[model samples]
Target: MTAVPQERRIVTAIPGPKSQELQARRLSTVAGGVGSVLPVFTARAGGGIIEDIDGNRMIDFGSGIAVTSVGASAEAVVRRASAQLADFTHTCFMVTPYEGYVEVCEALAELTPGDHAKKSALFNSGAEAVENAVKIARSYTKRQAVVVFDHGYHGRTNLTMALTSKNMPYKQGFGPFAPEVYRVPVAYGYRWPTGAENCGPEAAAQAIDQISKQIGAENVAAIIIEPVLGEGGFIEPAKGFLPAIVKFANDNGIVFVADEIQSGFCRTGQWFACEDEGIVPDLITTAKGIAGGLPLAAVTGRAEMMDSVHGGGLGGTYGGNPVACAGALGSIETMKELDLNAAAKKIESIMKTRLTAMQEKYDIIGDIRGRGAMIAIELVKDPVSKTPFPEAAGALAKACHAEGVLVLTCGTYGNVLRFLPPIVIGEDLLNEGLDVIEAAFAGI
Candidate 1:
C-alpha cells in the first residue's frame, strides 16, 4: 500500500547533483546552527524507503530520528488528516474546543501507564510538554528545584537546554538558563565506573544522596528522566535503577516525570519504555512518534496533579491542532492494525543478532544496548581502555549514507551509532540496511 519501493537503489552519489544544489540553497537561507546527518534531498518516503529527487532510493534506518515509526505518509494517517483538513485547519483549541483534541487526550489517558484516574494536556512539541510537566509538578508540590540526569536530552528550549546535559551543540553559548535545575548521574552500565553489575543500585544511591545533600529532597518539585535516553545515546538505565528512583520520588513528595518523548508510542517494543520495569511515572511526557509525523505532544498524569494547575494556565495557540489530532488517531489505529509493537520487538531480535555478530568481528564496537527498535552501538578506540571513537561513528554513518542507507549518530561523546528503522519496514529492507552497516563497519 506504500507508494515508494522498499529498497535501496543508488542512481548517483549520495548527495547527487540535485541534492548538492538544494544544500547550497539551504545553507544560504537556513540558520547556521541547523545540521543534517545526510544531505540527500527527499522527494517521497513510505514504508522503509526515502526516495530522493535524484531518483536514488535509500533505506531509512534513522526514521527521521525515530519520528516515523508508522512510516512517513502512512495511508491511515494521511487519510484521516486529509479529512480533518477538509473540515477545518485551525481555530486554536484554547479558543474553540474540538472533539479531535479531546479524543487525543482520551487516548493518552487510556494508553499511558497507570490505572488511576488520569488527565492529559496537549502541546505542539516534546519540549513544551516537558516544560509544562515541570510547571504542573511545581504547582502541585509547591517546590522549585527539579532534578534531571547527566547525558539526558530534553529539548532546545531554554529550560530543556538546562535539563539537557550535553554542551557542545545543544547547550553551547546558550547560557543564562532557568534557575534551580539540578543534574545527577544516570545508571549507564557500560560506562559505570565501578562495574556493570553494580550500576543499578550504586547510581540510584548516588543520585538520591546528591538530591538529599546538595538540593534537599523536599525542595525538589520534579524528578525527570528518559526511561531510555534518546539523544544521549539510546542508554537504557540498568535494572533496579528506575524502580529505586520511583520509590525515592514517592518517599519524598517529588513528582516523577518520565520524558518518553523518544521512547514512547511503541518505539521500544512496548507501549512505553517505562512499562518495561512496570514503573509508573507521576507525569509522562510524550511526542515525536505520537501523530504519525504531525507536531503533537502530551502530558498525561494523575488527575490530582494535572488539576493542580489553574484554569487556562496550560495551553498554546497551535497545541493539539485538529488535523494533528486526526493524524494521531489514525496513527494509533495503524499501530493497532499493524501490531507495530510486535514488529518493534522483531526488529530488536534481528538487529541484536546482526549487531552482535558485527561486534564480535570488530573491536571498535564497545557496547550494544537498547530495547526493541531503538538500538545503538557504542564505538571505542580499544576494547579494554574503552576510549570513545567518535571519528569511527562519523565515518560509519557517512559510508552508510553514501551507499544509500540513512543512519544516525548520537551520544555525549558522539560515539554511538543508533538505528531506528520504521517498525513497518519489510524484513528484506531491514536486513539490507543492516548489511550496509556491516559493510561500512568492515571498510572502516
Candidate 2:
C-alpha cells in the first residue's frame, strides 16, 4: 500500500456496501466508547488517498490524527521496517539493547531544538512519553505541582488525563486522577477575551499571575503545553506568549516541557512547532509522527534533566522495540531526504490561500489558522456573534465524506475542521481535497 491508486474515486456511498457490513461487525465487537469520525473501512492508505474495502477512494486530510506525515506506508519506512521484521521482531531492549534504539537517540540529539547536550528515552505512546517527562521533571526539580494550559490536551492515561483539559470523552468519569496538576490560561488569539492584540502579553501575565498567586511557582516541577495546542483546537499560542511562560519557568526553576506529540516531525512547517518561536524547552515529548505509522514515542531533553531520573526509572518492557526503532529511523530519513519541513510550508501556502478564500465566502468560517499542513477553520454560527457552530462542522465533515474526501472535526468546542495532509501528497491531489472542501462549504 505504499502507493494508492492516487485519485479520489467514489464507487459507492460513503460507508459503502463492504464498509457497512464491516460497521455492523464493528458494532458487535468494538466497545461503544471507541468511535470513528467516518465509518468507511480502510483497505489501504498511501499518498493522499485512502482506499476503502468497497473500492472507494477518499482524500486523506486527517493523516491518522497527524501521525502519518510520511504516509501510512511510506516506501522507505516499509523497506527498512520490513527488513527489520524479517531479521527479528522484538528483543526487549532492556534485556539486550540494539543499535537502532541508540541511533534514534543520536538522531534526536541532533534534530531536536537546543544545541545543548541532550538525551532521549523512548516509549510506546505519546501518553507514556508525557508521563515519563513529568516524572523526569519531578525527579530533577524535586517539586510536585505540574502546570498546564486551558484547552491543552495531553493524553488519556490517568496522569495525562489529569494534565489534559477536555472533559467529555477524554476525562468524563475518569477521575480520581493524579493530584497537583494546575491549569492556566492560554494565549488563543482568535477567541481572546481582550482581543488578539492583547492576547499575548495579557494572557501570559494572567498565567504567570495565576501560577504565582494560586499554584505558587515553588510547588511546580514543570509547565507542560503543546507548542501549537492540538485536539484543543489547534490554537497557536500568541506571539511572545510561550517565551514569556518559558522565562517564568526558568526564573522559578520549573521545567518547561513542550508536548509536541501532534505538532512535531515537520507537521508544523518546522521540525517542531516550538522551533517556530525559538523557544527551547527543558524537555519535549513526541510520538504521533515519529515512527511512520508504528506506535512509538519519546521524551527528549537536556541531558542533565533526563539523566536525573536514574537507571531503571525510565524504561518499559516494550519501549523502543527494535522494529519500531527501525521505522522511526526510516521516518526520520524520509523527512530529511524529502525535506518535509519545506513540504509542510508548501502545504500551508496552498491551504491558506484556499481556506482564506473559503473564509471570505462563508460567514461560518470565523477563523482560519495554523502553520504548515496542520491547519484548521473555526466554524461559527454567524460572523457577528462568532458563536461556535459544531453542527456546521459536523455537517461539513459528513458532506465531505459523501463526496469522497476524508476530513476531521476537532476543537474544544467541536466546531473546528482540522486538516492534516501527508507531506508526501502531490499538490494536485492536495488542491483536489481542498476543492472537495470548498464544494462541501458551498453545499452548506
Who wins the lDDT comparison? 1
- Residue-wise lDDT of candidate 2 within 1-444, one digit each (tens)? 436878989989888999999899999999999989898889999988899999999889999999999998898889889999999998898889989999999999998999999999999999999999999999999999999999999999999999999998899997899999999999999989879989999999999999999989999999999999999999999999999999999998999999999999999989999998899999999999999999999999999999998788999999999899999999999999999999999999999999998888889999999999899999999977889999999999999989988889889999999999998989999999999899989998
Worst 10 residues of 1 by lDDT: 1-10
After the best TM-score superposition of candidate 1, give how far the Cα of residue 272 lies from its true spot, in angstroms: 0.2
RMSD of each: 0.8, 0.9
Clashing pairs in 1: none
State each model's CA lDDT, in order.
0.95, 0.93
Off-target runs (Cα >4 Å) in candidate 1 are none
In terms of lDDT, the poorest run of 10 residues in model 2 is 1-10
Superposed Cα deviation of residue 68, candidate 2 (Å): 0.8
Clashes of each: 0, 0
Off by over 4 Å in 2: none
